[model samples]
Target: MSEPILSARAVRKTYQSGDRRIEVLSGVDLAVERSETVSIRGESGSGKSTLLNLLAGLDKPDAGEVIWGGGLGLDVRSTFLGMVFQSFYLIPELNALQNVLVARRIVGGIGSAERARAKDLLARVGLAERSHHLPSQLSGGERQRVAVARALMNQPQLVLADEPTGNLDERTGDSVIELLLGLCADTGTALVLVTHNAAHAAKTSRQLFLHNGVLQSAPKPIQP
Candidate 1:
């Protein structure tokens, strides 16, 4: 079998609050293969977001390691792991294409080829016509699409998304989810998504549940 694209082994995270220590995750283990989508389901305060942060290297774990295949290692924040958030964290001043271009620039110097690639990615996300529109001028779904395009600017090996559809209507959320999965499928990028919606969990190849700072496989065929 092919090696996992990303793997987290016995990961743990803890934070201190007023002289009290809170454990957000404990001994969590997960593996995601290339071209596969993995859903993480949990209630509020269940540490799903914390786990995602660790996997993406936005935050460090208290213990354990995250290994990346393809010689990427655990330095995801500095590596080619892309991330999208529910808040549509786009730059309000920059247009859609510019937002994506900015991400490419940060990964390295953006050349003409990189700019063209960003434009193409925006088009792929169905934002070609709105390339010049700023986040304030776009709808919620459009802004999220721009964020998705921006995440792909580096052609990342892994995409980490936190509640990516939580801010949209059902129809819009479904469309956005489809777009994300489609793009990841086409690019062979591994996806680790966090959501509370059971229906959304069913879309992924595997589903894991987070509870009380622990992670386990979700029940098969998560009920909608």
Candidate 2:
């Protein structure tokens, strides 16, 4: 089989608060296969976000390392990975289409083809009509859809989403999750979703729980 798209090897992380060292992660090991979807569920303050940041290379672990397949490295991160956050981090000034295009700012090659792709992604996320609206003009769900389009802007091999539906109502949140999964499936992109909602987590191909600063697989497959 091909090498895993991403791997976390014996990773550890800690945070210091007034001389108190908090162990956020402890010797965690994980491997994500290409095109596979994995969800991590945990209680509040369980360091799920910390683990995602480490895997994304946005933060370094206190020990061990995160390895990327296909010779991927931080310098070319935008070309290989995408990230989504609970807070729709769209530039308030840029419209939906422009916000989606923002992901390409670093890895420039923008032209007609790229613009078309951005439009296509927005459409995929069910935001084609809202492409011209700014974040302020869109509702919570629409804004999140724009963010989702932005995340897929680069066509990365992997996407790490941290509580993408945290701000929406249950019904809207469910739809966003479905849209995300559908888009990822169509693109053959691997996904690592960090969330607290058990129902949402169950949608992924695999489920895991974070506890005691370690990653643990679910007792049985949670996919349905």
Q: In terms of TM-score, which candidate is strongest?
A: 2
> Model 1, residue 112: displacement in angstroms?
2.4
- Which pairs clash inside model 1? none
Candidate 1 lDDT, tens digit per residue, 8-122? 8999999999999999898898988888899999989989999998888778888998877745755445347889999989988888989999887776797899989988999
Q: After TM-score superposition, what is the CA distance of residue 87 in candidate 1 from its true location, in Å?
A: 0.6
lDDT of 2 at 155: 89
Stretches > 4 Å off in candidate 1: 70-79, 221-224
Q: Write model 2 residue lDDT over 3-103, tens digit each, in one string.
A: 99999999999999898999999998999999999999888899999999999999999999999875577987887898989998989989998898889
What TM-score does structure 1 among the candidates reach? 0.94
Of the candidates shown, which would achieve the greatest lDDT relative to the real structure? 2
CA shift of 148, model 2, Å = 0.8
Candidate 2 global lDDT: 0.91
lDDT of 1: 0.88
RMSD (Å) of each candidate, 1 decimal: 1.8, 1.9
